[model samples]
Target: MRHPSPSSWAVISICIVAIVHLALGFSFGFSVDEAHYALYAQHLAWSYFDHPPLVGWIQWPLIALTTSEGVIRLIPEALWLISVSLVYRITLELHDVIQGRSSGYLTNVLPSGPSCGLMATLAVIAAPLPHVLSIGLLPDTLLTPLSLGLMLMALRWLRKERFSLGDWIITGVLLGLAGLSKYTAVFTVVALLMVFLSAKRKPWINQPGFWLAGIIACVLISPVFYWNWVNDWISFKYQIAHGAGGTWALRRVAAFIGIQIACFGPLMVVGVYFFLKQGWRNHRLTLLALLSFFFVPFTIFAALSGGGSLPHWTTPAWFCLAPFIGIGLAKAWSQQRRRLISSLFIVQIALCLIGFGFVLAGGPPSANLKANPMADLYGWQSAGQKAAELAHANNATGIAVQNWTLGSRAAWYAQPLPVYVLDQRQDQFDLWFGQLPLGANVILLNWSGLSYVPPTGKGAGFESCRLLDSLETRRFGQLLSTFDFSLCTNWRGADLVR
Candidate 1:
């Protein structure tokens, strides 16, 4: 036999990593967020109550394929390839820029040139926070790549110091796509604007590319804006409240920083080392560009810490960080400290394996509490199926649940069950399905608890709402959760309950 070339090994590595992620996706049950997004797949919309339509749009085709929790996760995980490709292109471009045309091809002959891009790819998928959380169907899954693409385009425009109308349009389109994925993408536009107005780049703004990118981006996102207007800006308002969940605390800001540390881990160490030793002062434009590109996403999420925000709001920043890490590792190759980068890979992989260990060991410490904040993913598939059988048996005209998560989860797991959310919040379902007919029979899954019963009073959307049966989601014969069931003999209601 023959030894595989480095290129052969690279292809093999990508396949192996891809297979592992697919296995991991299957290993866990649907997260509450996954369940919610899976619900989004059911009803096509211009925009949703809680988010823009792209996540759902991504899942729309998959609806025909399968709804199994693990399979649903693939919608985002498959996108990992795109993320890596963008990173590689950008890294390769940056490498060429820094080294110059004279040295570019000569360096490409060496192993490190190509491998830097691969390293960046691995850094992203291997990182624990984004890697694990990204598996579940989520907006960040799409947003991260679009964010990187937006940055890459902006970088290209600036690196050349030329307007290139084509570059601006592509940048605008990518920015639009990113916004569709997540509003945090607005930061990319801010970054571009900041760059356009900077001292060296100021003249570039007078060109059509400057204003056209903004206009095209706005035109691209017009659907969401129009949707917001029609829906009373519910998505924007929801995001505002959600981003700032509580009063500001300096500790949260600190915690957000700490999360980046944990998420980036040893790579963060290498990044700091590169900056300190390499002294980025020489690459001021590149550094300024990198910082500005990162500032929008990081600041948007980080600033909200005063109100309340999670550290991962800076998830796309990881996309930005990867190329920097890649460039650092590439430089290390010349100095023979390349082993440091290899060691970081081992540590990151080990950390992810440990995370997988915890996830696979599903039962939480106490069933009385939300287990690992992921308990919803477990035990609910079977319950949802059973609820569907019960609803069908009772001749239910509609299956109603009290909240979005349960409603979405139940709808997916319970095939043929047209689940309606009967909560104060109006999600995609209400907009499409509208009110259940007056005097219609309903099987209400009492989300409150086992002992609860719905109001039987006239015009409370029920002629009579009585507890029918209760199902206990148990683990090893211990009750994890108990949900009361109600059979509303004749639901009388139109429009949402206030």
Candidate 2:
């Protein structure tokens, strides 16, 4: 039998991955982030407190039409596939740049353009974090492809002496869309600037099209500024405090590095080594562009890891490096390292399967329900429904959670009823539901995973409170979490009742 071409293999890989993502989406409940972003759809706004509005705007139509978690997930799955295709396109661009080079070593090492593109696509699929993004939509999900598009445009511009009007417009629109996707996209703008300033010819600096691109991007991102202006810049303040809030710790930095290797897979690590070895000599400009995109945000996040940072914040940076990594891996395949490359792919596949198994099983039974990380994703659906029912039974005006993290799931699963966070911190929930009015009744939900006590004394927020129901959530006959619903009346705010 004849073997499939590299392009054919890429298509097959994408199809298979899509099917897997769809299955996972159907099998699991909405994750904490997923539910939070989905709630953004229900309440359409210029922007959100934690993120820009594109994530919610993209799903608004689907949310209006249906509430199925699986269907909502289709959006992210499609975005993931788009990101994969963009990576393939970027690999091809890299191949063309390398092929145009005079260096014999660079020319001899990399496989054909099609083969390089295939390897890059495969690298994205094998990565663990991309799979998670595919299963659930987040701000990063939308930003991934937009960031890749900006990188591709940068490469195309590098091929020419000057950028045309159309090129400038396209670049601006992509940058704008990226800004609308997430705040992290500012790194993309910085990367683009680095590429322009580092270029052999810098005449684009004096060009009219360049200024036009700036105006267009600013116009497109005006909503973020507009929303912040009206809201007293609360979102900006919150993000600043959030990212820089934690104390510095060496262990956090180490954990961050470990997560990058684990999520991106071991093969990409080898690929990075190869790129560093030959990239400077063979493709200096290309190396600079790719590295700027990858390292700018990556270095910031790594430094922030000592203070605090989420692993997924660097996803766009990892994606920006995919094309180069693809080329490196393709070279490895060309050399006699096929077995080693294959083993890495096998390990990645095994890790993906294990991750899915853990989700399906709703966390290990041996673990404490409160301590199980998977417990966050397992019990929200049941708990939300119980909260809603209890609220109705007790004639409560709304549902309350002690933390903002818990409000999203409750708000989403409970539907039109308002969900409020009883905590002191102001967040999206506070903006949406406002302070639960003084002397109002509410159904308080406390999950074993993130339990909190409802205050009921003379100095407490509530006048009186009693347990309404306890919901037990299980998967494969193993209890994953329990949620306690309490009916509390006459909330006098979180102050002494005089």
Candidate 3:
């Protein structure tokens, strides 16, 4: 029997992955970030407090048509598919470039470009975080494809002696889109510059195309700049303080490295080692160019990990290295290391499935609701519905959450009725529904995991409060969390803390 073509295999892999993501999307409730970003669409703006507008802009149309969680999730799923395809194309391009420069035992033994592309695409599928991103749209999901597109265009531009006008324009547009996607896109822009500068044949600095690309990128990202300007640059100030605010610790750095390895999966981790070893030996310039993409963001984030950076912040960097890792995996396959490859895939796939199950099961049942990390993804939908009903029955004007984190789901799940964060913190919620108005009756939602005591009396925000309902969230008959809904009347308003 003849084997399937590499392109055919890639299609099959993408389809299978999409089906799984679709199921997972339907199975889970909105994650804290997912709900938060989804709320972005409901309240349209140039940009948001914590992220740019692209994540919201991309979903605006679909959300207008329907608010189904699974349907809304299709946007990210489509973006993930595009990212996978781009990685394949990038691997093929890099493989061809490297092959042209060499002739010997290594070149002869290496798998074909198409095969390498397939392997790289599979490497992405084997990873866990990408799947989570697929289940819900995040800024990183948007950046992944935009970043890959910039890398591919950069590689093509580097291959030629003179830069093409079209390539420059495309790069500029992608950079702008990437900027709209996430602030981390600046790393991609820097990486592209490093690629051009580090190459043996330097790109002409005075070229009109280069300047045009810069202009285009600036034009595209003008909204973000304008928004920041209007908001007194609060977003920029917050990010700088957030990224570097934590105290440095040795264990934090070690934990960050461990998380990266686990998130990338053992197969891709090994692939990275092989990629660096082989690229440095044969294609030093190419290696440096690629490293520019990975190392800058990875190193900065790793260092900031000591300052409490999130794990997914390094995802785009890992994605930049995907093509080279694919090459490494392809070479291993050519050497008939089938057992090793099969074992790694099995382990990763199993882990991915187990993760999905954990989410589906609403995390492990525990007496302490805060101990279950997955509790966030479990009770929000039901709580939102319960809050809405209670508000209607009691003639409450809106729903109020003590923490900003709880506002997204309450606002999203209980639409048309505004959800307010009672806290004084300046967040996206503040930008949306501001503080609950004076003398307004509101249903205050309190989740056991992050519960807050309702303020009452003459000096407090409310005059008096009474328990409206208590909701117990369960999965397979196992209790996961409890949400308390309190009816609070006569808001007096408190002093703004920030």
Could you say which candidate leads in lDDT?
2
User: What would the TM-score be for candidate 1 when compared with the true structure?
Assistant: 0.82
- Where model 3 places Cα greater than 4 Å from the true spot, the runs are 101-109, 365-368, 495-498
Q: TM-scores, in order shown?
A: 0.82, 0.96, 0.94
Pairs with steric clashes in candidate 3: none
lDDT, residue 186, model 3: 91
lDDT of 1 at 31: 68
User: Model-by-model lDDT, in order?
Assistant: 0.69, 0.86, 0.85
Write model 2 residue lDDT over 1-498, tens digit each, in one string: 189999999999999989989998998788889999998888899998999999999999999999899999999999998899999999998787778752232544467989989988888888998889988998998988999999999888877766899999999899899999999899999998888876655588789999999999999999999999999998899888888848999899999999889888998888777656664565576567667899999998998899888888888888889898888888878878799888999999899888888887887779888878887887787788888888888889999888878888999889788998886777899888898898899999988987776877875789888997898988888888898988899998876422
Which one is best on TM-score? 2
Candidates 1 and 2 compared by lDDT, better number: 2
**After superposing candidate 1, which stretches have Cα over 4 Å from the reference?**
1-11, 27-29, 65-71, 102-111, 161-163, 198-203, 209-212, 330-344, 361-369, 415-442, 446-498
> Tens-digit lDDT track for model 1 on 1-498?
197643354466667777877888887567667777766677777888888888888887777677676777777777776776677777776656555553222322223546666666666656777765557767877887887787686556556746588987888788888888888777766776665554463476578886898898788788899999998998898887787788888888888777777886767457536633665444555556655776677776777876777665677777766776676765666678768777887888898787666555544446353434444445667767777777888888867776666776677677666777665565666775676676778787754322234545655657877777876665445455666667877766634343
TM-score of 2: 0.96
**lDDT, candidate 2, at 83:** 92
